[model samples]
Target: MTRSLIVIFTAIVLDAVGIGLIFPILPSLLKDITHAANVLPTIGAMTALYALMQFIFAPVLGALSDRLGRRPVLLISLAGAAVNYLFLAFAPNLTLLFIGRAIAGLTSANISVATAYITDISPEEKRARRFGLFNAMFGLGFIIGPVLGGVLGDHWLRLPFIAAAVLNGANLLLAVFILPESRPGSRETIDLAALNPLKPLRSVLEVKSLLPIVILFFIFSATGEAYGTCWALWGSDAFHWNGLSIGLSLGAFGVCQTFAQALLPGPAVKLLGERAAILVGVAGVSVALTVMAFAGQGWMIFAIMPVFTLGGIGVPALQSLATRQVDENSQGQFQGVLASAVSLASIVAPLGFSSLYFLFREEWPGAIWLSVVAVYALAVPLVLGLRPKAAERASTSRRRGAPENSSGDASGETADLTFRHPRA
Candidate 1:
């Protein structure tokens, strides 16, 4: 609605497009580069390398944004992304491609900064709805990205990278002129210790109550990596689909996910509560995955997408709840920590899932989805064990009655950070 929000959402869309652009074509590209029959492991390794960079830098950029303001960090990351895509476009060897991917990962760490920016500007009541739209914008980008990548890749393997570079270049310009700083940098001297990527993770871990949420983020993110790592390969193996078909399937999934995320998260949370909403989503995804695992024809995959899309409703709700777990000043740092958790998962999950898929590729390519369903199952107990909003309110009340800590950190007094309940 606001110009700032529009700009932020547009940036997210472009970023997602840049990411999705390579998905449909990555396997083929790797095969071309390595001249190997099995490029699955290479794909996994490359993805893990990308995530490894994000794991190390996401918090650094997020903390920097907290210190230097969100706008400058976003601008720098966007510029880096544009440059990295260009490098990827012209990369002649596997080593160069990996270099470009690592750079892209570093730039992709801006996601933490962007989430912090949104948290900075949105009121608590509006955060869930806004996060939903945030995901929707990303979904919309995926809708465009895979299709375009598939089409362009059919013509030339390098074209998608060029297109992505141009999109990110435009995204950089948009941010330069249109996006405003949501929060100003602190005037205090920069604490070099705070820039340590592990510092935020350690700080959050010291707060024991925060651990489950972090792990939940890890599990959710890990499950998500399987899709990006295996989707195109599975499509080709299972259905004999080409780049265009793979892209179309992904685009269709994106369309369904975008609509569901944009429209469902707020209502789902309102009606079922955050915990229950998450369970519903997990259930929906599990069912869809089961069907996918046993699907006889490609048409079945399309038919099950609506059910698959229901899986997205949980994340925005979870994000809205996670925001409640910390005070305003700590939001950027906390978000950075969460992004780090996600990056860590991304690093590990792709390798694990890709290996599992490699094993299953000969006999049952569809079995990979079963592995995802198993991972999804791991989150249920964690979700059920989460502190409810009422419990968080009670914790906040208790913290209010306690003496303030000498460090002036509002969350420092308790392991569970002070929670602010949104106005009804």
Candidate 2:
């Protein structure tokens, strides 16, 4: 692989591994620290805030990467994560836990930058495939991190954070040595407004095609995150699983997720194309959640986990499609916008599901999640039907028939007519 791709891949792995090691241990740790019996809501709030900060700040971070270069932005993010991990590892109180999570949220610009980095180095024809590969690496981290965290955490709750910090620090060293710069434009005077943390919202409104895609992204991303947001507590509550069991189960989920990411997207894309791939992946998530809702044992989830995971195919495919809506010069902005949308969903889903859990019971929350799944499924047709804008259509037409505004091919001459066709 190229230097930039390697850097990004390593960076993602480091991030995921760090996260994996900590996540399974966090709920139990929090419960111990705060002495709060029902900690999922708090956990949901932290996750929502994390997503919210990312949603709000992603644009600014992306824009900064555009001006300052991806390398610098990446270093800053990693360093921030290191500090956040240190705080988590040493937290003396629940407030400290909240603060550390909040810091991680505000500074978690790695994915946004990674998206920018992949777009920076990838060839046009290979972009989607490369993104799929990168996403798979990320999924692998999730797979391994939790299991390790769970195993290590059983010995000591704070151990995962120490491990996460070490990995992030190593990532920091790797970036310092190996990563190359990949921003598309020259630095301009930094715009203070762009860094306002709410800047992604303005960008979201600016891009018309981006709006629907963002909503879809929210539902899709929410499903994956919801599982993470609640799984540890859920496992503890329903199955009487310990931290080790929770970690192992998450590890299993991660393994299936890794498999999906590693192998699923390319074939799924080949079979369904981007939109259809997203549909199938979302379907998998929906089915998986529904299965879990009714599932009586951890073994059942293990049986069908891979089948339902579909995460490998879903997130990257949608992100690739979202990436296509803008030109290279604006990738950071678009990604920032999408990240923000994901942040909105992150906030809504966990809190929403947690509330449902509290209000009704664990079983009922399954129905609510199924509703989320259904809503996501409903969006597939709309996404599939989106047409390139008139300008894009015209440009494509010209490319195919440069010499004669109309190629002699009957198909070429007739294509513009398709554009003129009425939208029912």
Candidate 3:
């Protein structure tokens, strides 16, 4: 298990580094081949196009992984992404560029496969911690990738693409030799309908216990759009930040998040219990977003970065709880459904957040952050309801003679939602 985790961790970091390598040069690459008048809109369309393709393809890839096993699916996905980056490196026209983005989006569904792989090996009680470490690995890559890309981009606009392909090639080679297959076979056959985006989400919705968290997941994901869509523009306009300042600020954020995700989640869940941990994360994020809304200076933003990152605990906790609910064989499908929600959020969030950012950016620069605050605030109440009533929990603890120091998720394949109590 340790070896498996180590290998997947390395693979993910390499993949993320490749992605980060390109971020620094994508705008210049686009501008070199197209007129400026259409470049921005073209970028917007490409972003939406990629998200839309992922929304359509993620579940399909998820179902395929279930049938074929994770190893082959992952290898294929990695190879495709490598080729896509290469295509982008030498593309003669915008048509090829759009195709590259679409291909990347479709193949990036390997995230679901990767998460399912972790689920297969991790001990149930420690799944959240493992997931956190997994996130941190990618965070580490994001930190390295962009800085390296910036250095390389100074030499040539297309240089990063070549580097990305090499990084991905290295990842593929590592996986081929060291990564073992996690899921071996499927119990049921996958049909054409099973691959449809709505089909997987519908199956997931049928589970009553899983439904609320799924909804919370969607809301939480949409809220992410705020940061993804607005952070660069907002930082520049609000703080008069130059590229150096923006990169440094973002690098600071990655550092804080890496530590938070790597170290904070396990103890937080062990101390607060899974349900309460989610609540704490929600509260932290909501408060941070609120503060970020009116934060006047760049220093204030840096001060709040760690506190805001605590909210990320909510994600692993939520996933851990969901994993605890389902059996091993169905892990791929459940994760696929979650991926679908994330993809849908990617589609909706960019449009809504970017539109709001553009509409009120000048007259009300804080409007976008305020909107994110509202979205995150809504998650608090929704998650609050997921906890059992205090009176009921107390009574159940007494009836069962459960220990007073009880915390962490209830130990079972099924969630003990009916009597979950951190204090118990």
Give the per-residue lDDT digits (tens) of candidate 3, residues 306-345: 8889886888777776665455666776677777788789
Model 1, total clashes: 0
**In model 2, what is the error at residue 140, expressed in angstroms?**
2.2
Best by lDDT: 1
- Model 3 TM-score relative to the real fold: 0.88
Which clashing pairs does model 1 show? none
At residue 230, candidate 1 shows an lDDT of 92
Error in Å for residue 311 of model 1: 0.8
Please give, for residues 41-116, the per-residue lDDT of candidate 2 as tens digits.
7876676666666766777777777778788888999889888889989989988888887777767656777888
Residue 329 in model 2: lDDT: 61
TM-score of 1: 0.86
What's the residue-level lDDT of 273 in candidate 3?
72
Off by over 4 Å in 2: 31-45, 93-95, 229-249, 287-300, 309-311, 358-369, 388-424
Backbone clashes, each candidate: 0, 4, 1
**Ranking 2 against 3 by TM-score, winner:** 3
Off by over 4 Å in 1: 25-42, 154-156, 233-245, 358-365, 390-415, 418-424
Query: Once all C-alphas are superposed, what RMSD does model 1 give against the true structure?
Result: 5.2
Give the lDDT ranking, best first. 1, 3, 2
Record all residue pairs in model 3 with backbone atoms less than 3 Å apart, i.e. clashing.
406-424
